[model samples]
Target chain A: MNTVDFLNSREDLLSPGISACQGCMAELSLRVILKVLGEKTVLVVPPGCMAGAAVGGWNKSLGTKIPAAMPQLGNSASMLAGIKAAYDLVDPDVHCLAYAGDGGTADIGLQALSAAAERRDNIIYVCNDNEAYMNTGFQKSGTTPHGARTSTTPVGSVGRGKVNFKKDVPMMMAMQNTAYVATLTPAYMNDFVEKVQKAATIKDGLVYLHVLNPCPTGWGTKPENSIAYARAAVQSRYFLLYEYRNYEFTVSAPTKNIREPKDVTEFLQKQKRFAHLDEQDYEEVRRVVNSRWENLKKLAGL
Target chain B: MENEYRVVYGDSGLYVLDTASWRTFRPVIDETKCVNCGTCLLYCPVCAVKKVDGRIQIDLSYCKGCGICRTECPKQAIMWVKEEE
Candidate 1:
């Protein structure tokens, strides 16, 4: 849809004055998501920054105009599974959505999410990957990049930030042949909106969307730079923007045409989390990001 | 029973936070340059930017002043004015 058409789409579903940090991408994401999902949507935001920010509501009330709930950290997927099943009998038109963090999806709730995908549950699951558990003081998550520092992955003599590379959740889901799996960022609004609208249409199986939620507080980025950093992340190919479904994988726009991606350092240097990374560290990060991009390309070729 | 209900269920709008104080900068929309393209309205985390009547207006009461609207505006119609003491 064009800008003017997008303007008239839907009213913002979130109540004003949520406590998300300045330029909170996750908050922007949730607002747009709920707008796309509309009133017939039932939202389940697990224990993350979004939940702590009151998407699930506070004080015996609801934060969203629609009914919402905060499930246990690990039970987010399973709980949504149950709710979607119930909604099938009661109101099948109702959209059942789970907005979770990487800590919840990759570390804690992987099994349940996997099971739901395998069983072909018609639910939308979104992992807002801020790269760490930001609400709980930015502990390193399974999706945290190798050289980025978090509270747990300090840049001290003993620790060189996160030791391992980020776990590729969307690729994993795509490999399983889920109904739909896509990575998105708000920086690319058209692509982001189109994918979300597509996710809402699939009634055959579970849809997994991993959104780049840049945490201004946790990542030590200027709040205004969140979208710019998001755009850079894709430009540098540090995070590939692509979608998978029906055994077909296609890289989306922004990063799709680039031959030589902008240096990974262009993306990394802006964040305080990568402040301590030296030339050697940048080399390793470059290796990891490039390999992952090439791997996705190879998979697409197959 | 009424006292217990009041304490537990809470007063009206008890959870609504006034996020205006979080601002370090305020987005002032330049009327001459703005065509009401709605980019600012699209990217706001709080959805604080709105189109009231024919013009785009920002609700400062809820605007956290992240300056996202300013940076993303195509015409550079929104200015980030510093909030001073």
Candidate 2:
């Protein structure tokens, strides 16, 4: 569909007053996702930004108007699997979506998620990676990049932010050989919508979407710059947008042929989370980012 | 006396909850300047802008007033106005 047609066709499932911070891309992603999944979808959200964004404060109902179940931390995948199993008895066409943050998917929920993938559960699992434990107050998580500062990884004397690299959850899911695995960002709205649509069509096994949702509050950036940062991430090759299906890997259209790539340093400098990085730290981050780009190019047979 | 709760299943009809009270700033479109290009409609996170009868309408009920539509409008047709308390 064309841009206008697609925009007009959206049946916005999310209500306002969600308490999501201004320009919170997790909320944006959830809205777009519901538009694609439509009314026959059941959402299973754990305790994270996605849940907080949907049902916060005095709002007891999940504003999406869809049947939603809130599971404990790290239990979303299994809960969604159970929900999908029960739905199979009545209506097998209902989409079961498990949405979680990086902390829920990469750290606390990995075991259950892996088990679900192993069982070939018919569900679509979405990991909205904001790169930290943002909802609970900007603590470092497994996906937090090295040299980025967070509450847990404060840049103080004898402390140099987070020392570990971001976890590659998409690669791990692809290793499981699930029906579909892809990375997306809300900045690329068309691409993001298409991927979610494609994932919904897969009936045999699990479909995983690892979306990079830039958090203005946690990332220490202006809310207006949220989409700019997302675009910068792709242009700098810090986050490669690609899909893995049928044992084949292909980079998405936007990041596939990036001529005159922007420097990763420019992208890092925009966020206050990386303000503490010195010259040597910048070099280290650049080296790591370049190597990741090279590795992805090799995989894509460039 | 017995305490009882109704267990409703998938029957919560779409609730059109008005969220204008939560808005600190609301988007006001300049109709004369607008070309109905639909650029603002595409970038609006909440999908608050709707096209009805070939004109764009912003539904304040679902609009969190994020100002993304104001920021993304190519024609600069959307203006952010402070909501009166």
List-wise, what DockQ does each model earn? 0.45, 0.39
Per-residue CA lDDT of model 2 for A1-302, tens digit only, reads: 67567758877666555667777888888878888888899988889986776542223444566777789898889989999999999999999998899999999999999999899999999999999999999999999999889999888888889999989999899888877899999877788888998998999899999999999889998776778788889998889899998888889988887887898887899689998888899888889888988888888798
Q: What is the Cα-based TM-score of model 1?
A: 0.94
Runs of candidate 1 exceeding 4 Å displacement: B1-14, B52-54
Tens digit of per-residue lDDT, candidate 1, span A171-218: 888988999999999888888988999999999999999999888999
Tens digits of per-residue lDDT, candidate 2, B1-85, equal: 7744333233253323455666788888899999988876766666778888878988887677667777777798988888886
Compared with the true structure, the alpha-carbon lDDT of candidate 2 equals: 0.83
TM for every model, in the order presented, reads: 0.94, 0.92
- lDDT per prediction? 0.87, 0.83
What's the DockQ of model 1? 0.45
Strongest candidate by lDDT = 1
Q: Where does candidate 2 stray beyond 4 Å?
A: A54-60, B1-19
